[model samples]
Target: MNHLKVLALSAGALTLVPGLALAHGSMRPSHGGVVQMSGEIMVELVTKPKALEIYVTEEDEPIPAADFDGTLIVTAPGGAKTRSALKAVSGNKFVSSGRPGSGSKVVVSLIEKKSSAKTFASFTMK
Candidate 1:
């Protein structure tokens, strides 16, 4: 009887692996972080590093930025816009170097070379 219960519990735990993998960082009201995913665009608005990270995901949830050669158009404070390119960071993540000021809005526009789809994320610092 004990062995049967153990097996059932193990099976249940295994079933949650895929579900957990599919779910990325969640933006809860308690943590003051918001993770927005719409279609293939995922945006994580964070004020810590004074930066905003925009992630482009494929239909299979794989980050497309790894092999994506794109341009990032960033709009800074006082309505100043600058264009920068993206580089791969190790695994499936891309990083952009910028320091945003407090209470300033960041606008990121991503344009992939191989595709015509454009993803955008705008975050305001607090």
Candidate 2:
């Protein structure tokens, strides 16, 4: 019947919504780090020997590091948590001192200065 056809069409359209939502950009990490997609924004976390790096991008383009205020929360394997402020280092990079140990979990939260929008990315160190 026509009613059944309409319902089927509506269901099909709903399935495509998610795909369209993710069409804004690729989720791959461009900075040799782990990447997470927060809505249309992409956040990448790079762990170094003595520092942590955070990168933010939207629509596959880097968002200026100066536009955000960020914080890094690292939970060690033994359950100790350390919090550090992320400072803008360059174009789209934010850095914080102290490297997270293996088996540690890192969470970076960034707040946009102009809109106050928050983007979060989580990573588990190997």
Candidate 3:
């Protein structure tokens, strides 16, 4: 009985390997920022005292800035919400000159310049 149970568990574990191998982007920050994955794409957000920057990538490949435009909507600690537009600075990097204070929630939306495909990500300030 115990041997049969072990075999069943092993078969179940093996079945999960493919899904794990095809898992989404990395969580390790590449540019000293916070990262989240949307499908196969990775979104990284960096907060500064006077600005907020976002970076996007897929499978470790940088997504060109010229291909997308994005916006950030931040909910402040005191409950006020502010919207800021992001301008591409370089490949995979977009910047906006305002920050949502710590403990706030930031939502970023991007529209592909050519295809018009859209993607979104949300992060809580640290």
Q: Pick the candidate with the highest lDDT.
A: 2
Candidate 3 per-residue lDDT over residues 59-99, each given as its tens digit: 88889977888889888889998887898998889998787
CA displacement after TM-score superposition, residue 56 of candidate 2 (Å): 0.7
Candidate 2 TM-score over all chains jointly: 0.79
lDDT of 1 at 79: 76
Instruction: Tell me the tens digit of each residue's lDDT in model 1 across 1-126.
Output: 999999999999998777645544443322245555655556544444744444544443546565566455655567776767655664445566665666566555565556766667666655
Query: Which 10 successive residues of model 2 have the least lDDT summed?
Result: 16-25
Ranking by TM-score: 2, 3, 1
Question: What does each candidate score in C-alpha RMSD?
Answer: 9.0, 4.8, 4.9
TM-score of every candidate = 0.54, 0.79, 0.78
List model 2 lDDT by residue over 1-126, tens digit each.
999999999999998776644378888889799888887778888878888888899988999999999999999999999988999999999998788899999898888999998888888988
Q: Give the Cα RMSD of candidate 1.
A: 9.0
Q: State residue 95's C-alpha deviation in candidate 3, in Å.
A: 0.9
lDDT of each: 0.57, 0.88, 0.86
